[model samples]
Target: MELLDFARGPAMEWAFAIFIIGVLWRLFGIFFLHHRRDLNEPRHGGAAPWWGAVKTVFSRMWPRREFRERNTYSTVLGYVSHIGLAIVVFGGAFHLLFIRDLFGVSWPALPTAFVYLSGVVALVAFIALLVRRITHPVLRLLSNFDDYFSWFVAVAPLVTGLMAVAHLGARYETLLAIHILSFQLLLVWFPFGKLMHAFLFVPARAVTGYVFTRRGAAT
Candidate 1:
C-alpha cells in the first residue's frame, strides 16, 4: 500500500536524465532534417496553388468544416492517440500537482474519472493505429522498426498506468513503480521516435500542402 516507497532514488534520477537527453536529441534531429527539405519543389506532383496549401491544412483541422474530408484511418488514429495522450499528460491531477509542487505553478486538474477515461481512449486509439498498420497494405509496406517501436513506446505508459490504478498485481508498489518507469521511458523515447510527429506534424503538413498545391493536386 506504501507506493511511494518503491522509489529507486539514484537509479531513477539517472534514468530520467538519460531519457530527457534522448528526447532532446531526437527532437533536434527531426527539426534539423525537416528544415533540409527543398521547399520550392513539390514532394509529389499535381500539387495545388501555394495559397491553397495553407488553406487545406487550416480547413481540415478546423471544427465543423464540411469541406474537409477525414484523413485516412491511420492518420485519424494517430491523431487520436496523440490528442488523448496530451489530455492525459496535461490534464491529469498528478501532473498538475507535480507542477504546483515543484515549480509553484498550478492548472486545474482533470477529474480522476476523466484521467482514467483518457487513458482508456489513448490505449484504444493506439491499438487501432497498430491494427491499421497491420491491415493497410500501404502502411504495412511503410512499416519499419521505428513504426512498431513507437507503438510500444506510446502504449506502455497507458497499460502500466491502468494496471497501477486497478492495483491488480502481487505488489501494488511494483506495478506503480513500473508505471512510473514506463512514463519516464515514454518521455525519453518521445523526441526520438515517430512520436516527434507532435512537433513535426504541423510543419510537415504545411510542406506537404505546399507541394501538393504547386502540382494542382488535392487542395
Candidate 2:
C-alpha cells in the first residue's frame, strides 16, 4: 500500500514532469538547428517537396527494396512488437483511463483479454530481438549500453504489467506499484534515449524526403 501510494502520487508527478520537459527540450533543439538557405531553383523531374515530405513519412515504414530481403524477418517482427505495444498502450481500458486522467482524452478501449495478449506477444518479440542481437555478430559488435538499457526499459513495463495483471510475485497493490514504477523508469529515459525516435523519426524522415526532393532525387 505504501509503495503504491508513493508510485501513484509523488513518483508519477515527477516522472510526468520530467517527461514533458525533456521531450519539449529535445523538440526545441531539433526545430532550432541551423538551416542552410535554399538558393537553387526548384529542380524538374523531382517529387514536389511538401508532398514528398508527407509521402516519405509513411513510405519509409517498410525497408527499401535493396535492403528488404536481408532484414525482412527483423523488420516484420519489429512491426509486430511495435503494433502490439501500440495496442496495449492505446487500446487498453486501463491505459485509456490513465490518458484520460492525464490529458482529458476519452475513447473506447479494446477488451482486456486482448490487451493482455498483446502485451504478452510484445514481450516475446522483445526477447527474440535480444537473442538475435546477442547471437548476430554484426549486431553484437554494435550493441552498447544504450541498446541494452533501452531494451530493458522498453520491456520492463510489459513484464511488470503482466505480473500485475496476474497478481503474481506480490500482492496486487505492490505488484501494481512496481509496474507503475517500471513505466516511470521508461518515461524518464524515453526522451534521452532511442525512444525519442518515436517522436522524431517522422519529422526527420519528412525533412530528408523534402531535401532529397529539392535535389531532384527521391529515395
Strongest candidate by TM-score: 2
Instruction: Give the 10-residue window scoring lowest on summed lDDT in candidate 1.
Output: 62-71
130 in model 1: Cα distance from truth in Å?
A: 1.3
Candidate 2 residue 160 C-alpha distance from true site, Å:
0.4
lDDT of 2 by residue, 79-188 (tens): 98999999999998888999999899889999999999999999899899999999999999999999999999999998998998998998988889999999999999
Q: What is the TM-score of each candidate against the true structure?
A: 0.71, 0.94
Model 2, runs deviating above 4 Å: 38-41
- lDDT values, one for every candidate: 0.73, 0.91
Model 1 TM-score (2 dp) = 0.71
For model 2, where is the 10-residue window of minimal lDDT? 210-219
